[model samples]
Target: MDTEKVTDRKVELEKEDGHALHKRLSQVDPEMAAKLHPHDKRKVARSLQVFEETGISHSEFLHRQHSEEGGGPLGGPLKFPNLCILWLHADQTGPGPSVPPVYGLEVSDVSKWEESVLEPALEIVQSFIQGHKPVAAPVKMPCNEMENKRSYHMCDLCDRIIIGDREWAAHIKSKSHLHQLKKRRRLDSDAVTAIENQSISPDCDKELKEKGSPEQNEKELKSSV
Candidate 1:
């Protein structure tokens, strides 16, 4: 691919709104977008948003996510070493005998990666190590689920805890869920979608149908007249 063209695309993506960015990514790199889990979509979007606003390179973004300085909602640094190892494995024929286990991965090796895989990748994700330092940490999802409460289903996209099976069922067809699903390039005629739809309560579907019915609209119109 044209390196400059790729770089420009990355730059454009960085500047785009999160939802729009996701849509563009889905169109251009659907495989990569599809690999993103639902729970991670917002986090990735948040990271992309942070990168766009701060002009940080993706590596720097990952570094911040891996470090304690990025704050609590980001989980921990260990979450990234595995990703690094995955990168390494993808680069080599295999791990090569010298490649260490995931837990043994080190930041010192990041320099090596930077020279090889990272530098090339940077063309697609320009970094801002020297300028426009971030003013604040990126926001993360609040996964607050208290013990012993009404049953809830945490949205894999936004992480909002929705209570009740019926409510959760209705939520799957909601705009928020659809937005997130599209963001992850997951809005497909797949078994997963089937399962989510199948989980909806019959009553909720009826209510939704009634709410959208022309008869209800006509009734309201007649009453108002």
Candidate 2:
């Protein structure tokens, strides 16, 4: 299918009437429409255009893609299964962005750059070139009642939802999660220090001085009498 032509047609339909296009998409591909917002004109029109051009719902195409070999619930199979990503950063100890299967390079110290970063990176590349699997195998869950009733866990520190107890345990021990936890502890400590060091406002101090105390007033009255 010529995706570019479909895209152009979708754009034309959206320009004409986005609401009407979304309504048409709902009629032809209710599943896709339910997943997308009514105000998402681009996706709505594209789904409609896809149905008009090929008589097949856009959702069906996605289902087929996901059902292919090496594909699961996530989406289509990886274009490059052996893809290697390397991240070079100055502060390895500090909180860094989260991404899976990444090799981090410490670029802060020039002296150790070769020994720490270059050698390790070279070894990884060489292993990959020699047909050694760079990525780890996926964990296989046992087919049982426990697998069926797997509960989801949400990490408040990292703001991520992890499925299955094993995944949740691994996520908590991950570098990203540890970094975020460290950062959170540091922030809490700073907040406690700030609160402890905080002083009374000038206006509040002045009001307290003006009010004095009941005991002080009674003493003044007794002195006057």
Candidate 3:
């Protein structure tokens, strides 16, 4: 991929109106559009450029990549099958400090580096090499509900993109969205009422006057005679 060209395209896309670009993307690549936020201009542009250059949708390309050997539905294949990650971070201080998992080493204390960081990381690596599971079980985190399962929805009334059924339902029932709906209905009703109450135009009135009632026409004819 040409990084510079992609960057230029991204800049051009950012210069255009985000909503218009989003609408354009939706028409061509609805799946990709659904996955991206409209305001995420860089990514949105990259996807568009992929289509423009290759005549293939970005979503299709991603699907193909994910279908490759050792790949999962969500992402491309791992480079190393036996890869074991060991994360390291400084110890955090707060009311609710999130401690890292077993393989995650805290490098807060230099004196305890061997005990706190090096030893644990070595053990994890050793287990991987020996084809044995680490002493500590891996933590299982739940997948993101929106990214994994739900489809994106755009609310015409509210002029916003909502992800997932629960969020969409909540948005429609929101006070602001309801207010906008009521305002639009009221405007439409008022327009109808105005049209109904409108008086005849001057041209119509003039025509009516010229073609008077039958009795008036008869009187005018007699007068002329």
| Lowest lDDT 10-residue stretch of candidate 3 | 93-102
Task: For model 2, name the residue pairs that clash.
Answer: none
* TM-score of candidate 3 against the unseen true structure: 0.55
Q: All models: lDDT?
A: 0.49, 0.69, 0.75
**CA RMSD, predictions in order:** 22.5, 14.3, 9.5
Model 2, 1-225: lDDT tens digits are 666543477668778666677678878887776666556678778888888888899989888888998765546777765656666754223222222245666677888988877887887777677878544332222233334113456789897756556567788999999999999999999998877655566766788889889999889899999
Top-lDDT structure, candidate number: 3
Query: Which of 1 and 3 is ahead in TM-score?
Result: 3
Clashes of 2: 0
Highest TM-score, which number?
A: 3
Candidate 2 deviant stretches above 4 angstroms? 1-7, 85-126, 133-225
Higher-lDDT candidate of 1 and 3: 3
Error of 1 at 16 (Å): 0.9
For TM-score, candidate 1 versus 2, the one ahead is 2
C-alpha positional error of residue 22 in candidate 1 after TM-score superposition, expressed in Å: 0.9
